[model samples]
Target: MTSRRSFIKATTLASAGLLIRPSALLPVSSRYIGLQLYTVRDAMQQNAAGTLQRVAGLGYNAVEGATYTGTQQFYGMNAKAFAALLKQQGLVMPSSHYRLGAEKMKGADVKGTMLHGWDKAVDDAATVGIQYMVCAFLSPQERGNPDHYKQLAADFNKAGETCKKAGIQFCYHNHDFEFQQQNGQYPYDILLHDTDAGLVKMEMDIYWVTRAGMDPVKLMNEHRGRFPLWHVKDMDSTPERKFTEVGSGTINFKNIFKHAQEAGLKYFFVEEDKCPGDPFASIAKSIGYIKKNLV
Candidate 1:
C-alpha cells in the first residue's frame, strides 16, 4: 500500500506546475465509489454473484460492466435478472461497456452492440439500471483511415439518440491508441470535435490518458462537461508502466480527482485491466486507499 504521506507528496508534486484554483482543491463532488467489473473478469466468469458480493464487501456501492455476452446476457443472466442480482448485493450498475458489432451482419442476426442492435442494447441497459452505456473498445480491424473515426462520430451520435430516448447516456471509452497521431490528427480530437457533446459524452480512462503522456485535467479544462464517466485506473512508476493498485502506483489521483467537477464526472470506477495477483485483493486495496483518500 502507498502510505498517506507518499500519496500526498505525489499529489503535491504532480500539482506543482499547474495553476490550482481554489475550486480545484475541493474534494470530488460525487460519493459513489465504483468498480469496473472487468477488473475481475476471471472471477466474474466463474461466479458473478460471489464476485459482486466481494466487491460490495470491499465498500464499493457502484460498478461499471465490460462484458455483454453474444446472447445479450450479462454474466450469464438476462438484463432484468442481472439487475436483480446487483440489487441483491446492494450494488447499482450505473455504467456498462459494449462494443461496435460487425460492420456487416446478416439480417436480424446481430447481437446487441453499438453498430448492430443498439436499440436493444440501450433497452437492456435501461433494464439493468445503467445510466451510462459506453462503446468499450475498437478492434484492430475496425481501425482504418481518419474518416472512420468521423463515421464513428456519426454512429455515436445515432447511438446516443437511442440511449437518450431511453434516458441513458452514450459514451466512448478511450485507450492510448486514440491519442496517437494519425495523418497529423489525433482520432480522439476528431471524436471530440465531430460528436455532439450532449449526445456523445466520454468515459475517460485516466491511466491511458496519462500513459499517452496527456494530462487528464488539461483535457477536462479544454472540453468542459464532455466527460461524465471515468475509469480511474493507475500507472506504475517503472518504465514498463504496468497496471497497479490505485494508490500503490505513480499516478497522482488526488490532484486529478480534485478537478472532477470540471470533467463533468458523475461516477468514476477503479479499474485495473490486468492485476498482479488475486484481483479481489487488488480491488480491496484500491477501495481502501480511495476511501481513506481519493473519493
Candidate 2:
C-alpha cells in the first residue's frame, strides 16, 4: 500500500503546471457521493425496494441504475412505481445504464432505426426523472472490425440527438478494451474524435482505465470537460489488483479528484464488482472512507 506521505507527494507532483489548486479540490458537499446499484446486484435481484431502502440508509442521496431493459421494469416495478420507491427512500437517480443492442444496429440507419426501443427507454427515463442515459457496453461482434467503431460513433451521435430531444444527455461507458490498439489506432481515440462532443459525453470508469495502465488525471486534462460521470471504485494492492472498497486500495482518488473540475464531473457512483462479504457492508465502508478522505 502507498503511504500517505508518498501519496500526497505524488499528487502534488502530478498537479504541477496543470493549474489545479489543492484547496479548490476539497469535497464541497455530501451530494457528490452516490451508489451504483450494480454494486448490490444480488440484493437488488432479490428485493429491489428493500435493497434501495438499505442503500439510502447508508447515506447515499443519489444512485445510478443498471437494470432497466430486460425486465421492461426498474427492478420488477413499473417506471412510475420505481420512481415512487426512490422518492420514498429519499434518493434520486441521475443516470442509468441501457445497453445498445447489436441486433438493433443491423440494417438500421443511424438517424432512424439504429436503436430499438430507445424511444420507450427515453420515455421511461424521463418518467423516472433521470438526466442521462448511458450506452453500457459493446459486444464482441460490434467491436470485431476497426471500422465498426466509426459506425458506432455515428450511432452514438444519433442516439445523443434522440436523447436531447427528450431532455436527456447520452453517454458511453467504457471498459479496458476501448484503450487497446486496433490496427495501430486506439478505438477510444476514434470515438472521442469522431463523436460530437456536444451531443455525446463520456462516463469514465476509473478502475478500468487504471487497469489499462492509463492515468485518469491525464485523461481529464486531455479531454477537458467531456466526462461528467465517474465510476468510483478501488483496486487492491495485490498482484491481481482485485476490486476493494474505496480508499482501502492502491488507487489515489484524492489525486484524481483534484482534477474533477477539468473532467466536468458532476456526480460519481461507488461500484465494487466483487466484494469479500456483503455488498452493502462494502459500500458502507466505501462511504465512510470517501467522507473522511476522498469525498
Candidate 3:
C-alpha cells in the first residue's frame, strides 16, 4: 500500500549484484545434450574414472554409453565404481546403446547376448538405472525382407511391453540400412507403421539419417514424438562423407533444434565411432560449439 512497485524494484536491485539462487538461473543450452561415451571409449579405457572426469571438465553433465569394451564395463568402470565416479563429476546417464543383433537374442552356449546375461533383454536394462534401452546396431542377418522387419517390430513391441513394467522404454537406432526399400516401402516406414507407437520409439542418429538421404527434420515431423533421443554427429564436407565434430560439419543444427519438442527429444548425445586426433579435444570443440552457437 505504501508503494508496492517501488518496494519490488528495491528488492530486485538488492539481489542484482548477488548470485541468483540456483533455481532462479536458466539452464545452459539443453542440459540433456550429453555425449555417448563411445566417442571417447579409448580414453576411458586408459583411465576409467579419470576419463569421465575429463568429459565432465569439458562441460558434459550427462552421458549415453556404448557399454563395455573388453572388460571395461559401461561408463568404463564397474557399476558401483562408475556410479561413484559419475556422482563426483555431476553426471547422469539417461540412456545407452546395446547391440541387438539376432545373435544377441539367439546365442549358442551363452543363451543370449553376453552383455545381457538373462533369458530376456528387458531385465538387463533395469539393472543399469537407465530409463531408455536402445537397440544400437543390427547385423545384416537381421535385414532382407519385410517379414524380417515386421518380426523385429513385433519383438520390439513385446520387449517394450516388458520394459513398461519397470518404467522403461525400448527403442531402435537406425543406420542407413533402414532407408533401403523393401517391397514398395522403405524398411523404416514398415517398422514405424508396424510397431506399436508406444512400444517402439526411435532414436534418430541425425548424421546417419542424413547419410541415408533423408531429411532429419521431416522425419521428426512425419513421425511426431516418436524420436526420444538423437545421436548428434556431423558429416565432413568431403564427398567421402567422413565424420566431424559438431558445427564443423555440414548438418544444420540450428534449424533442427526448432523441432526439438515435436521429436519428443529428451536427450542429444555426441557419438563419433572414429576420430582423427585426440578425441577428447574434438569433443571439447563440439561442446564449445553447442554452448556457443547451437545453444
On TM-score, the stronger of 1 and 3 is 1
Give the deviation of candidate 3 from the true structure as CA RMSD: 10.6
Candidate 3 lDDT tens digits, 137-175: 777865768887888878778767665665567788999
User: What are the C-alpha RMSDs, in order, of all predicted structures?
Assistant: 10.9, 11.2, 10.6
The alpha-carbon deviation from the true structure for residue 16 of candidate 3, after best TM-score superposition, in angstroms, is 31
- Evaluated at residue 81, the lDDT of candidate 1 is 86
Q: Assess every candidate by TM-score.
A: 0.88, 0.86, 0.83
lDDT order, best first, reads 1, 2, 3
Report the C-alpha lDDT of model 1 over 1-295, residue by residue, as the tens digit: 1243234323432332222344754346444789999999999999999999989988898899888835788999888788779888988787899888754445454488887667667767766777788989888867767999999899889988877776668999999999999999999999999999999999999999999989999999999888888998778888899999999988899998888888888888999999998988889999889888875
Go through the candidates in order and give each one's C-alpha lDDT: 0.82, 0.81, 0.72
Which of candidates 2 and 3 is the stronger one according to TM-score?
2
Provide the global lDDT of candidate 1 against the true structure: 0.82
- TM-score, candidate number 3: 0.83
